[model samples]
Target: MYATIGIIVYVLLYTLINRKQINQHSRKKWIYFSLAICAGAAMLLLSDSSVGWLTKYLNNTIGDLTSVVISE
Candidate 1:
C-alpha cells in the first residue's frame, strides 16, 4: 500500500537527513526507544486495531514529552 511506501521513504529520508544526530544519540537509550515509534507505524500496515493500540501507547509514552517540547 501507499502508506507502507510512504513510511519507508520517510524513514529513509529522515535517517539520511539526521544521520549525524542519530549517531550522536546512538549511545543513549532514547535512540532505541525511538524505534518503538517506527514499530508502531509499521503496525498500522498490519491491522486497523493497531491504530487505537498505538495511539494509546504513544500518547502514554511520548505524548507528554512532545507537549513539553512544543510548549518550550
Candidate 2:
C-alpha cells in the first residue's frame, strides 16, 4: 500500500525531473529504467533471505579460515 504509493510518486517525480532527457532518448531510457525497476523489485523481494544466508555462509567461512590460521 504505502510502498506502492511511494514507488508511484518516485516515478512521477523522476519522470518530471528528467523529462527532457527521457524524451530525447525515450526508447532506450525507458527500457533501461524498466530493467532497473525489475532488478530493484527482485532485490527487495530477496533481500531478507539472501542477507541471512550470506551472513551465515560468511561467518562459517571466516571462522574456518581463522581457526586454520590460528592452528598453523
Candidate 3:
C-alpha cells in the first residue's frame, strides 16, 4: 500500500522533473530511473536497522577516541 503510493509519487515527480529531456533519451532515462527507484526502496527498507547499528558503532568509536585523547 505505502510502497505503491511511494512508487506512484516517485514516477510522477520524476516525469515532472524530466519532462524537458524525457523525449530525448526516453529509454535510458527509464532504465536509470527504475534502477534508482529500486535501489532507493531497498535502502529505505534497510535503513531503519542499519541506522541503529551505525549510530551505535559511531558512538563507540568516538567514545574510544575521546578516551584515548583524554588519557594522553
Give the number of the best model, judged by lDDT. Answer: 1
Whole-model alpha-carbon lDDT for candidate 3: 0.70
Give candidate 3 regions above 4 Å deviation. 1-8, 15-47, 67-72
The numbered model that scores best in TM-score is 1
Residue pairs in candidate 2 whose N, alpha carbon or C atoms collide under 3 angstroms: none
Clash counts for all predictions: 0, 0, 0
- Which residue segments of model 1 deviate by more than 4 Å? 26-29, 51-72
lDDT of 2 at 5: 56
Candidate 1 clashes between residue pairs 3 or more apart in a chain or in different chains: none
1-72: candidate 1 lDDT, tens digit per residue:
678667767876876787788778746457645754784576578666756887888998899889999999
Q: What is candidate 2's local distance difference test score?
A: 0.69
As a TM-score, model 2 comes out at: 0.39
Tell how far residue 45 is off in model 2, in angstroms. Answer: 6.6
Tell me the tens digit of each residue's lDDT in model 2 across 1-72: 456556666766776787787777849677558846854665554345755787789879997899899999
Q: What is the C-alpha lDDT of each candidate?
A: 0.73, 0.69, 0.70
